[model samples]
Target chain A: MNEIKIFSPATVANVSCGFDVMGFCLDTVGDEMVIRKVDKKGIVITKVEGFDLPLETELNVAGVSAIAMYNAIEVDFGFEIEIYKNIKPGSGIGSSAASAVGSVFGMNELLGRPFNKTQLTEFAIKGEALASKCEHADNLAPALFGGFTLVKSVSPLQVLEIPTPEDLYATIIHPQIEIKTSESRAVLPKEVKLSNAIEQWANLGSLVHALHTSDYDLIKSALKDVIIEPHRSKLIPLFNEAKSSAIDAGALGCGISGSGPSIFSLSKGLDVANNVKANFENVYADLVIDYDIHISKINTKGVKIIG
Target chain B: MNEIKIFSPATVANVSCGFDVMGFCLDTVGDEMVIRKVDKKGIVITKVEGFDLPLETELNVAGVSAIAMYNAIEVDFGFEIEIYKNIKPGSGIGSSAASAVGSVFGMNELLGRPFNKTQLTEFAIKGEALASKCEHADNLAPALFGGFTLVKSVSPLQVLEIPTPEDLYATIIHPQIEIKTSESRAVLPKEVKLSNAIEQWANLGSLVHALHTSDYDLIKSALKDVIIEPHRSKLIPLFNEAKSSAIDAGALGCGISGSGPSIFSLSKGLDVANNVKANFENVYADLVIDYDIHISKINTKGVKIIG
Candidate 1:
């Protein structure tokens, strides 16, 4: 396949109890990309649509990630890329990750799958680092491997694909406010109470077990964040109200997705997910802030060919 | 079933990355107890053997736990308990937990099993608090529910029983040194680095996932302690050497079992577990320190009726 068209899904990172390590893919929201092998010797971004992101190879996440992948292998011909962005940058829904994963996924497909998903993740994070300002695999892993992912360690780049329950769905509400990743990280304390840390890890452990067993009640109980959310949620408008509304509308759990301005609620079924979305919409409707809301099933396929 | 004699299993809590939350039962190392109903008004420790322990109801963990259970229930009669101790106190194994669990379990059995294991754990922790100076279900949950357990929460207590892989075994080496629970706890920092906390939770989440899927390699990778072990291991003699020897002998992972002095290693099979035990024996043999070592399969049944 000399030319490839692929849909790269968006992702939710720092999933409540699983801060800095866990994430899940969203099926309905993503970025579409088209790539073609050319006789050129270097990576190039031919076009970017729907968002005025940087087109320069060094500045754009997609270009940077593709360059990382390209430099690692001996490819005589280079690739030209076109990105159709749907996920807003800094929406707290892994916008950069979608772009980063899209380019490498397409390249790997064109190269007859030379690299594995883990290697693709490694390449993708190089681009992701430009956005997050550090190497983190929580978003990149899910965007590549799909479903739920737990980044066991960043240094070793170990990512474990946790099972996604069939009925699980996510409702996301993105309030039109920019919370820069660096700024969001700044609000967090360098140290956390050891007791709270223990509670957080216990919740994380149980949440992982709940996912494997498909135990909704356990999931409800386990999806708590005692560390990062308290500090970061202050930056988001009506964060508590949105979370409460979603939970009251039958979401299993609700929390600030990634660094915020976006809040995510997980529910067991599509109907509940829709209910959560409606509640989120209601939460933002009275406010002057512009917002976007979506309901999505768990995406089992990360980045896949569309044409 | 008015009177019963039972064997209560020992447990290794704080399993590597799972400090303050996780534990598993041991098959061969435990304590024995006999509990019988009487028309008396309150819990009574009728006899004590195999070790010098408090026979007073309030001072004895079994009696304290039995009283807790007794106070919660509408029992017409009190209970008599006789102890035959096997697990050594302050060995970093669940010695107090066995006694605490034994009384409540026997009472529940004699009463036609009115309280569930979770409720029994609630009563058991009342006694465990006497030993550890806090209510922790890590050891009690495993000693009651058997196999592996994660105490997700201490307040409004929630315990999750994790599946034990059929081939899994534990090798425990107890060095004859005293590390009081309070002293061990005092060694831990009140706060930890947020980065380290994230790493710990990630390992714990992955460890729980590994247990559910029976992934040995994942377990091996996930069984890491980055938070509490650094401070607590200093209290244990030859902690680093013992861990290295265990890993060198094919153990999946090794760390301070509960607090200090005792170290536990997990392996995939009986042969490797035995090898780990032998290596542990070798580590302490050349030194002047006396040590005890035992290898046992994962105990799926916790406290059980013996006669």
Candidate 2:
């Protein structure tokens, strides 16, 4: 297969109590990419559509990630990538991760599946760093491995693929307000109270167990952020209102999606997810900011061949 | 049942990454007690054996826990408890928890199980506070719920009973050197770095997932303590040597059982657990301090009736 067209899914990072460690893939929102091997020496970003992004090989996430994977393999020819972006950057729904994971996934498929998911995730992290300004795998791992992923250790890059409940769905709302990655990170405290940290880990542990057992009630109880959200939520407009509305609408839990300007909520079924989406719309309609809402089932398959 | 004899197992709290939140019950190391319904209006400790402990209802853990459960119910008759203790206090093996849980468990059984495991744990925590000086349930939850337990929250009192693998075993070593609970508490930092907390929670989340999936390799990788172990290990003599020896002897993971002086290692099977026990023996043999070691399977029944 010299050419492959694939769909790379969006992801939600900093999942409530699992800040900087846990994330899950989304089924509905994503980016479409086409990659084809050519006789050229290096990677080339031939085209980009739907959103204004750098087409240069070094500037674009797809190009950078593709190059990372490309340099590690023994290949005589280079690859060309074309990305049709649907997820907006800085939307806090892993727009960069979709582009990052897409290039490596498509190239791996065309290269006869030369690398495993972890290796692909490693390559994707380089691309993700281009947008997020850090090499974090919470989003990249889920985007590569699908389902819920836990970045257990970053130095060793060990990620655990947690089971997603059958009825689990995600409702995401991206407010059209930009929050810079630097500012988003700057809002975080360097030190946290030991008691709060313990509570956060306890909630995270319970959340992982709830996912394995498919206990929706436990998920609701475990979906709390006592450390990161209190400070970062201040950066997002109407974050409190959005979260409260989502919870009232029967979302199992709701919190800031990534950094800010976007929020994600988990529900047990498609009906409740749609309800959460509607409530998000109701809450955001009163504001002047333009917001987009998407309801998606937990993506069991991360990047898939489309053509 | 007018009178009943029971076996109440010891437990290991703060299991590696799950500090103050996770614990598991032990099958071999435990205490025995006899509880009976009496015509008296309050709890009575008629006889105490094997260890010197206060017989007063307010001072003794068993009497205190029994009173907590007894006060909540409208029983026309009181109860009599006889303690036959085997576990040593301050061993970091939940000796206090055994007595605390044993009393509530036996009282509940005699009272036709008026309380659930969570209610029993709440009562047990009251007794555990007499020794630990804190209201925590990591030990009490497992002693009552059996298997593994995660104390998600202390305020509303939530505990999650996690599944134990079929082949899982524990090796515990008590160095006999006393590490005061106050000194242990003083060693912990009030605040921790955000990065370390993230790593700690990540490991904890993975550990829970590993337990659910029964993946020994994942458990080995996930059973790490990045936040609490470093400071607390200093309180225990030869902690590093014992942990290294246990790991070298095929233990999956090892850490301070609760605060200090006692260390617990988890292995996949009985043979590996015994090997870990022998290694612990070798490590502590050079020290002048007297030490004791016990090997136990993961106890599925927390407190059981023997007569």
Candidate 3:
């Protein structure tokens, strides 16, 4: 009998000012992937729950990841992968990333962990590229390094593991609305105003410094996006109102989760996190509020195997 | 007899990615202000030099800075300020910043150093506000800090002083051409595509990481600007050739200096700096090369009193 393995962890991509260059793993609300060696020289995937995901080699997130990893290393191993999808897809919770990352991570362990974190991240990106049609490291960094990670550079893939502050709490509210990555991406303009770009860089620079020095106030002030958020927010109904409520309820910063419909907030304490979660609930009363409020700390461990 | 007083070093506003929010002071270039107390309770301008400068309060950089400072702080003391400008006006080398910063520094000393670096920087920003008609901190931070400084936040005006690596050499080539800040500002688009913004953020994040770790290769890779440099490059004659020459001569990175007309290159050693300078000289033989080929070290000391 083949053994069953599982790897799961939540992830936040496009972290506040970092946009595509930063992300982090959370202790809860992630996807689990189980892989077992098969006799045949081909890959197979089973999507178990939460997301109505596809099972085809190219369409399935886990299958794509497994195939990319195997092909990149020229491995002829056949494997059957199962994605126990916990995080809702299109919820800005890195749902797809969890599957992709989990598959790569589990397979890497099954294959004796031949690749490093970067190599794993690259494999994860290949999966993401198939889904999003663009290679981005935002989700991959956190899924690999764990905790609060900065994808400092994508090509040659540099990941910096930022020290997560002790008082930090994340309050994630999923509004159960679908905002496809492609559609969310379409609303944004092809060119950004120089003024907006300057502000973005300024905020991003401050955000990096804040993360490095653990300056909470700087983080609060720098959690602004004049570039992508404004247009992307328009796609999500009551997005601005939800964000405003979170801020008023004592969030250090709040923005659309991943790409939208799901919103996340960083706060100083559990009380603030609760307040922020309640605020989001209050604002979007009509929507299905799946409150995954976590006073939980950053996940220093990303994807890991469970037997 | 008139009292001799020295002023703050003029700064290069917007150190590439840190536009409007980041700046650094240069030791070699600045403006000098000599202030002697007079019987009248109003600022009296004695002389202004270094390019055809305007002495009128609204039009003059130093005059506007002095006016803003006096108005804000309600200083009743009158003094004669003679400006000995080393940084040429409209040279994209923060010539106007030097004047404004010089005025603030000179006045602060004349007022018995009543303000700290932060306070002086705020006062200097009055100068920047007057010159650019926009409140920006990039030039002021460098003028006040005197090194590769990062403006972490502009509103509460937080600045982080980054240590410049010892092995770094800066080769600045002033082509003697003029590109007005207004024109440069106008040429850039108001809206950038989401993809381009992502790339910009990626590069910017990498650059910050590079700066922190002193990773020269990462810095070289991260110095790319897909947003402003390309559009602004058109205005600067032989910009492409100069950049190529500088890079071929062993510079780590090359880009437009501040706005344009002046281009700078980051190199590893004195040999590289000399080689870069020689290359620039060879390429643009007719244009008088103002090669500021100096060892690139972080300016630890910002503005100081010199008698």
Clashing pairs in 1: none
* Candidate with maximal lDDT: 1
Interface RMSD of 3: 2.3
Instruction: Calculate DockQ per candidate and list them.
Output: 0.93, 0.93, 0.52
Sort candidate 2 into its docking category: high
Candidate 3's TM-score reads 0.89
Tens digit of lDDT per residue, candidate 1, span A44-122?
9999998999999999999999999999999789999999999999899999999999999999999999999999999
- CAPRI tier of model 1: high
lDDT of 2 by residue, B1-307 (tens): 8999999998999999999999999999999999999987899998888788999988999998888888899878999999999998888998999999999999899888878999998998899888777798988999888999999988899999898989999999999998877788888999999999998998899889989989999999988998889998998889999999999999999999988688999999999999999999999999999998999999988889999
Residue B64 Cα positional deviation in candidate 3, in Å, after optimal superposition: 2.7
TM-score of every model versus the real structure = 0.97, 0.98, 0.89
* Residue A137 alpha-carbon offset, candidate 1, angstroms: 1.3
Give per-residue lDDT, candidate 1, residue B156: 91
User: What is the TM-score (0 to 1) of chain A in model 3?
Assistant: 0.91
